[model samples]
Target: MASTTQTKSNSGVEKHADINWDELGFDLVPADYMYVTKCGKEENFTNGNIIPYANIAISPFAGILNYGQGLLESLKAYRRDDGRVLLFRPEQNAQRMQIGAERLCMPSPSIEHFVEAVKQTVLANKHWVPPPGKGSLYVRPLLIGSGPVLSLVTAPEISFLIHACPVGNYHKGPINLLVEDKTHRATPGGTGDIKTITNYSPVYKAIAQAKARGFSDVLFLDAVTKKYIEEVSSCNIFIVKGNVISTPAICGTILPGITRKSIIEIALGFGYQVEERVIPLKDLFDVDEVFCTGTAVVVSPVASITYGDKRVEYKTGAETVSKKLYDMLTGIQTGRIEDKMGWTVEID
Candidate 1:
């Protein structure tokens, strides 16, 4: 908490001393500090520190010198109305990063280290935290193969770093998406369940095509039958029918988003039947509503969906449930709602 002493200016706008129970939007200039650490082929994680954020020198044979061995996680920090700094379920991001690290045959940062590093980074930039309601800061935790070697095979040298930016909604409002039955986001026994870099580049071609056609995102289907839904490039998909909520099961091909899980729990609490099973694209045209969940989108409604030659429209283009869920989430995040799940962690 910032000191409770409040400062008053001549115009009558008061400044918070230590505790800021209020939050306002900020214009983010990247914080001046960051945390970095490295690990060897056989080692676990190494100790590191926060330093001035700037340029770095790298060897010609860095592990990421190749193309596929890297991973990242994204989340946010808020400066609430009273000037309190908070992180929403940062431990989930840290745990997901640990899983992603291991998927690439790299070292995993202990959850404690990951959370501590995030707190340290946020504390280092407390002054830069925009006020509440202005888009919050986007925190990105990245891991890359830093081992110095020139080869196509995976060897040791892995590294971790944390960076943040003041950010807003990824997509401002209801978005149009295309059903992708052609390409695969991840293969069986692949890194689909993890948030690794190698897993996402495969969709660039599909994503490019969709954007070219004016679609905001791609709705990927199952790799096998090419019938059921998977997820968007950066989010998990959900469809609501009256009182029921449906999403694709985590059958090893989806990112198993943290937001997805939280929404499911919230929906259940609201007396809705949340089902996790195979969700076919056919359901979209017939469902009551549909939307997406992610660290970025949180919950963005789907007004309409377009494929090559067909479009699926819903009566209630704006989903009542998704909007409610989003409100519940942001409410908890901004300290206006209860934290029943213990997701929010106060930074200061």
Candidate 2:
């Protein structure tokens, strides 16, 4: 790996030392450049530009610091065998961020501007994209209220920025989940469906406690009923039974994951019956297989789940539905398989 001091010019690509792709974890390995743009109350987004990856100065009393007026999106850039870079469903992420901004009363980039900024950032740091079959360059786009404010109100100015990092799996190996009976991830009339910054920090304590108890992740239930499964702390959950696959419905309580949507479409294409409905906590005990989907952890198999006194375990490893979905999804992403769904956008 190269030192962080290694930089790239906007007009030319710089080749850094080879990274140990297989050994890559989900840590942030900084790239050479980032995209930044800003907007005010009276103006749309200005033409963005690429700059060296560094921190920005913000006011101590910024609205993002006080009112939690921020949103984020996560997508990945993949390297194919032929040395081309591909982005998977970035438009979906852009659209989701737009909706999140609307809900949070923050300004966001348009879909075209968001996609272009992502592409520019990826291209500027194309050398950081991992090799095929190894990992990907994780792209994170953030929108925050940068202007200072004392009272509880939306900031007049907003900042949109993007950064890329070479990364691997978010959760390693088969995972064990702890069902959270106490903490609630989202309520019915709250900011549950959006990727707002405030929605994540509230669940840190629950996730930390679960990890301390030797669980891989915490599973959250609905705030009102507590009997129906909503989602995991960071990803969406699904269960398989024979030829049928089902996941909890996106009923304004769970974040609509891009990978979850892709998996549902791909499963339906394979003639598997797919259903999106409320999944009672009791249903997990009788499921044949269980898994999770997200941007960071593409697909992860669930080995066991602990809910109160009842502990349910499932079979994981090769030849499972999760394995198939992972293979198909990654294949399409890396260009090993035909992309019939038009989900991938290749960079020139």
Candidate 3:
């Protein structure tokens, strides 16, 4: 068994799991506990349990197993230098999950219930949170159609679950992207704007191809136009040109990322013009910098993008917009800077 050590935290004396903080990465280092709740179709979630983390069994014909009726959200808990744990805009994540649950036909948890459950899970696994600046504890909440239903319909039962893991940066440094002309991520009026589980796996092949070709991820275009940039495989995309910042609008195709929304606000606060519109592919060649935003990557500067025979490189380093935003965002997240926006929830 791995050793454990006691530490004085905001949640009182807690036993921390023995692990190497310096070698943390964006992989699952399973925390000790998880949160789970259940509801019938059209019912509201009320009661939940904090259980030890382990494998779960489900029916073979369950809705999530057969018809892809599931939604998920990702948020992080940061350990401050003062031993306090903070969660960044978890209410936004709760709202997003509620929206996605409606689309996926699963019973949604109330925002209060959802946020409370997340807090319980994080506190239960408080020992897993890395030290300040070492990494963070990644909290993932999932809503799934747990009841068995062979027909193509909503399951009779729904489950809301939350789990956590300690992780580092999703991307180590500046990343290169391959613009995928084919295999669109979502169509008009689809579940792209939400965090549905079905929205992810279809792009695995494209991302795999990009990784095989020495690229970090694949950048997809709008399904309807095929010429306008939509998003990276897992995050939202943005470009900087002159004094304006442009990103694809959340027009039922791109996920409205929490980090992306936060960055837009920060940019406007810094006196930069921000535009949410359809960004054309050719515009990448003229941009000064490019970056992606999501819960995992946070803010990642794009080193270059390859489309067909042409490759366009963008600006990266300390002087770029992404770096400045990253510093401010992380500073607020880790308590290095004051959270003037009141975006963080202090876990006691």
Best of the candidates, lDDT:
3
Candidate models: Cα lDDT each: 0.78, 0.89, 0.91
Worst 10 residues of 2 by lDDT: 4-13
- Please identify which of the two predictions, 2 or 3, would achieve the higher TM-score against the true structure: 3
Q: Candidate 3 residues 68-110, lDDT tens each? A: 9999999999999888899999999999998887777777988
**Quality of model 3 by C-alpha lDDT:** 0.91
Name the runs in model 1 displaced over 4 angstroms.
1-29, 315-319
- For all candidates, the clash counts are 24, 0, 0
Name the lDDT value of residue 333 in candidate 1: 83
* Cα RMSD, each candidate: 4.7, 2.7, 1.2
Candidate 2, residue 148: Cα displacement in angstroms equals 0.8
* Model 2 Cα lDDT, one tens digit per residue, 1-348: 355334344334456436677899998788879999988844678669999898888998888888898998999999887778899999999999999988877778889999999999999888888877778999999999988988787888899999989998888899999999899989998988999888899999999999999999999999888899989988999999999999999889889999999999999998899999999999999999999999988999999999987889987999899999999999999888999999999876
Task: List the candidate 2 regions with Cα displacement exceeding 4 Å.
Answer: 1-14
lDDT of 1 by residue, 72-168 (tens): 8988888777777789888898888878776677777888888888888877756545566766767878888876766675556777888776666
Q: Which 10 successive residues of model 3 have the least lDDT summed?
A: 1-10
